[model samples]
Target: MNTEAEVREEMGYSESNSHRLFSVEEYYTSYGKIPKLCKFLGNNIIILWLIVKANKDMHQLVYQKMDCPELLQEAVELLKETSGVGEDVSATIHDSKIKLNEICRVIKEVYEVVAKGICMLGKLCMHERFLSLKV
Candidate 1:
């Protein structure tokens, strides 16, 4: 499992970079952790997409969230694993996740799959963190 901090550090990425995960308002706010977590989770999903692309067997069973066609379950799972806030974020990310049984044959489709996953997760990140806000 990749910890958010570990992933960021190993990638030579700091919060200050242009791709800085969040704005100043977010960094200091109570709900900020969710956005940062989403970035890490989404990055990991993108990495997983690459890994899945290279492998044959593993690509067949790409886990996706229910309902939404473009979203991947991995991003939600990543947040659950890394942030300790499972339910709310997953609910937000898993709006539409369609299954792809044969990823290799449709190799070119991986980019779109990944792009949709990224977009869904971005939407999730932008949503107000209900759990953190409650806390």
Candidate 2:
């Protein structure tokens, strides 16, 4: 468990704004709204990704390195519409199970993209460190 000060430091917040850190009692009081908050965030991919990044216990959004298939599909469809990923996804039927393969394929694709992005960020950080040492 992270102390409030550690969390604030990781987020790059100044000590003067420490009031933003919520107490455990406050979290317990607001716990009942979590379900509604999740429902609201369901369609928001950027926010969902931020939650996945910020949460230490991320099993609620991702378990065993996989997002929920239905949620993943929804995110893919939203991206297709907004980012022009091109055309509606056709269902791939197998063993009389419709769209199962499509869901699996999308999940794999998302995992690859996320892995590559993390790798790129790691390389970028190392490059920056190397350059700083040369100064």
Candidate 3:
């Protein structure tokens, strides 16, 4: 597995915005409310893009890529492992799936905007670079 730092570095220079990962600790520190943390992180398009970018490199070449259903299942497993909780927590997580859906929706929409912005900037930069090339 690629280390988190490696992933972060690869993702950092891909766009103008500085991508920050949302840890549970950082979430509590910034928002203090676990319920709203996902929503907050969702709106940060750069970071959301980073999350998607991190997975971009995987499930290629030697193996089939994980589809969305597989990804969701993996995420649930990760949550169970990280939380170290049993059925009660599982029940809570089940109920909170709506939160996950909302966050995913926000992330997708924000990312589309960021992607368009980046493409526009890239075109401008390319034009600038070409003009400079002749100087």
Highest TM-score scorer: 2
In model 3, pairs of residues that clash are: none
* Predicted candidate 2 versus true structure: per-residue lDDT over 55-110, tens digit per residue: 64754422222235744664565454433212213334334454766766655566
User: Where is the poorest 10-residue window by lDDT in model 2?
Assistant: 82-91
Better of 1 and 2 by TM-score: 2
* Per-model lDDT: 0.47, 0.48, 0.46
TM-score order of candidates, top first: 2, 3, 1
Each prediction's total of clashing residue pairs, residues at least 3 apart in sequence or on different chains, is 4, 0, 0
**Tens digits of lDDT, candidate 3, 16-62:** 22233333332212333322433434444444555567766663423
Per-residue lDDT of model 1, residues 1-135, tens digit only:
555466467455565542344345433222434346447555545446445677655645333333443335646644444443333334434656423533322443444455556655655654435335656
Number of residue pairs clashing in candidate 2, backbone atoms closer than 3 angstroms, sequence gap of 3 or more or interchain: 0
CA shift at 32, candidate 3, in angstroms? Answer: 36
Candidate 1: list runs displaced more than 4 Å: 1-105, 128-131
| Candidate maximizing lDDT | 2
lDDT of 2: 0.48
Query: Can you give the lDDT of residue 23 in candidate 1?
Result: 40
For model 2 the local lDDT of residue 84 reads 26
